[model samples]
Target: MESVSRDLDMPDDSNPLRRLSLEQLRRRTSMKWRTYPHDVLPLWVAEMDVPLAEPVAEAITDAVALGDTGYPAGTAYAEALAEFAHKWWGWGGLAVGRTAIVPDVMLGIVEMLKLVSSPGDPVIVNCPVYPPFYQFVGNLDRPVVEAPLGPDLRIEFAALENAFRSAGRGSARGAALGAARGANRPVYLLCSPHNPTGTVHTAAELTRIAHLAREYGVRVVVDEIHAPIVAAGASFVPFLSVPGAENGLSLMSASKAWNLAGLKAALAIAGPEAADDLARIPEEVSHGPSHVGVIAHTAALRDGGDWLDALLRGLDDNRRLLASLLAEHLPSIGYAPAQGTFLAWLDCRDLGLGSDPAEAFLKRGRVALSSGRAFGTGGEGFVRLNLAASPEVITEAVRRMASAVV
Candidate 1:
């Protein structure tokens, strides 16, 4: 691992995705690298194929050198996020007072749900979203209601309105929670720059959502972990920055952009109207983040801008590269260049792979990808490919996938 790091210690302007060799990546034991046989090209999970940003690596190293491993404390993580948001997304409204540090984005979401809802109450989601949105919400005993995205992979207001109304309908669970919380409002768990498809919601779309949530008496909680991974010509609109969203909540982190997922830490931010509810999150939840995770996240938000820019450049190139490769070798597969996040959602129905093309790719092509079936409704006959690897590897993966069909 140390040798791999040394090989990847390139200038900030260089493409980090191309720094490490395939042999070096094989040395990794992370779920992404170790889940398949050595011959398979792994492009399934959210993990990035890059080394740590210099500032993030240094921060973690310095903390360990000083033996400063202790429980997380202070608001440095929130403050750093505020600065980053203000500079990058033009979001100057991130209130540190309204933020709480949680173990990770999913856990923070679970905690937030508890504040505005009860078990068995329906929690709405844009279908074919992150698989964990279903797993975690269901585990909490809260039923998930699908408001599947439109054919364009963008939110369909009519579908969302239908979900909100359906979730608001009287039920044993809804009546119970309504009586206690003063209203039987459902919670919409939105995935901005949505997973698999990578659709970045426009500000107008978000403002419309906020209006609908208000009209329908619904609560909105967003996972903005991919906020920083957006490509050029597109912008990320922070949910809390738009009008009518003063009651919405969002979870943000530097973990995704900086490849610091193993170091678990994320901030749950409340809108001005939702601060009291956010405060109700159990005090013990604050203790869940690692001191090291906080330090690394803060450093990444505060000083890793250059490294992140380099990564976005590499990912932009890779997205275009994947499009061309598919057009050349696997023209039957449907794909749109992702607007954000290093993931590609492929329409494989045309390939006759029957529901999950990823299975065929892994078995016949020795390439591992995420099965779209796992993403829920509207995900059938699709697959998700990770685009955060070297151009060479991405090209090879496309060749392998094409060969699978042949």
Candidate 2:
């Protein structure tokens, strides 16, 4: 393990993320850095190469010094999240009482689904979505119905309504589900500031979705883990913030925005009308979060705004940097430019690299990016680029990607 500084000195430029070099990044054994060969530049995962924000690091270190690493406890983590939500998103009345701690965002989504649907019940999702949406919902024995994204990479309401209607009309799981319960209802899993593509659903769009979800008896569960990372000029709309959305559930965390994935903590926030359903989650599920993870996440919410602001500036620079890098190295590649998160969904179909373009880039150019096909339908001939690195790394990754095509 590369040692975390006991005392961090804010760098002269004050962008701690930009200070990391290729060699320094390689010294750590995190999955993102160590998964690929030494020669390969790995940008396939969501992990950021940034160092910990001082306040978060200090909180963890303080716990370590005091031997406070016991099983997770307390409402501090959830309360911290509520505070952050209120301050940044202007989300008032976020009752921490209606929230619960979970292992992470994905796991929380899994538990939330259980509250709304039964095994074999139809669950609706938008694709190309985060790949795990399929895996986790399927793991629960629920059938996932895809509502393909529109050509503009935004939600297609017509497609979504079709899926919801089919789900309401019932499917293979309908009879069994209906027989088990008096009536059968489905769950709609939404990804706000959606993964890979980085489209932040507008408040009006979300309100429409909420009305539709209520009309169709579909419970909505939004994965808002990327809520804190929207670009400077863009705005992120929290699902439950919209009118008529009080029955939906939202999952959020500091892990994604703060580069603390390995810490293992997240929150599942419930809308006012959804509190009863949230309370249905088994108490044992709360045990999954790491005690120290809560401490670190709390500190991030309470005291790491300056560091987060700095990292955001660095990431904004990298997003623009990735744009020019693509233009110079592979003008043929199609990119919409991400407005949220450090992810870029690039169109590689024109490159004629077949279904899995990342393979060629890895084998030929020694650059590793996430393959598009795995994200589901409409992802064919595309790649998800990570824009959470230094400008030089982003430049080099694209250069190598262009080289791979030749």
Best by TM-score: 1
Candidate 2 Cα lDDT to native: 0.86
* Candidate 2 segments whose C-alpha is farther than 4 A from its true place: 1-13, 169-181
lDDT of each: 0.90, 0.86
What is the Cα root-mean-square deviation between model 1 and the actual structure?
Answer: 3.5
Candidate 1 — which residues are off by over 4 angstroms? 1-13, 169-183
lDDT of 1 by residue, 1-406 (tens): 2343444444333888987777778898899988888888899999998988999999999999999999999999999999999999989999999999999999999999999888877899998999999999999999999998999999988899888878874444554566576665579999998997999999999999998887667889999999999988999999999999999999998888999999999999999999999989999999998899999999999999999999999999999999999999999988999889999999999998898889999999999999999999999999999998888778888888988996
Best by lDDT: 1
Q: Write the per-residue lDDT of candidate 2 for residues 1-406, one digit (tens) a residue.
A: 0112211222325775666666667898999988988888888899997888989989999999999999998889878877888888888767889999999999999999888778888889899999999999989999999999999888999999889888874443553565466576688999989998999889889999998776666789999999999888888889999998898999988998999999999999889999999999999998999999999999999999898888889888887888888888898889977788889999988888888999999999989999999899888899998888766677778878888997
- Go through the candidates in order and give the C-alpha RMSD of each one to the true structure: 3.5, 4.1
How does each model score on TM-score?
0.95, 0.94
In angstroms, how far off is 99's CA in candidate 1? 0.5
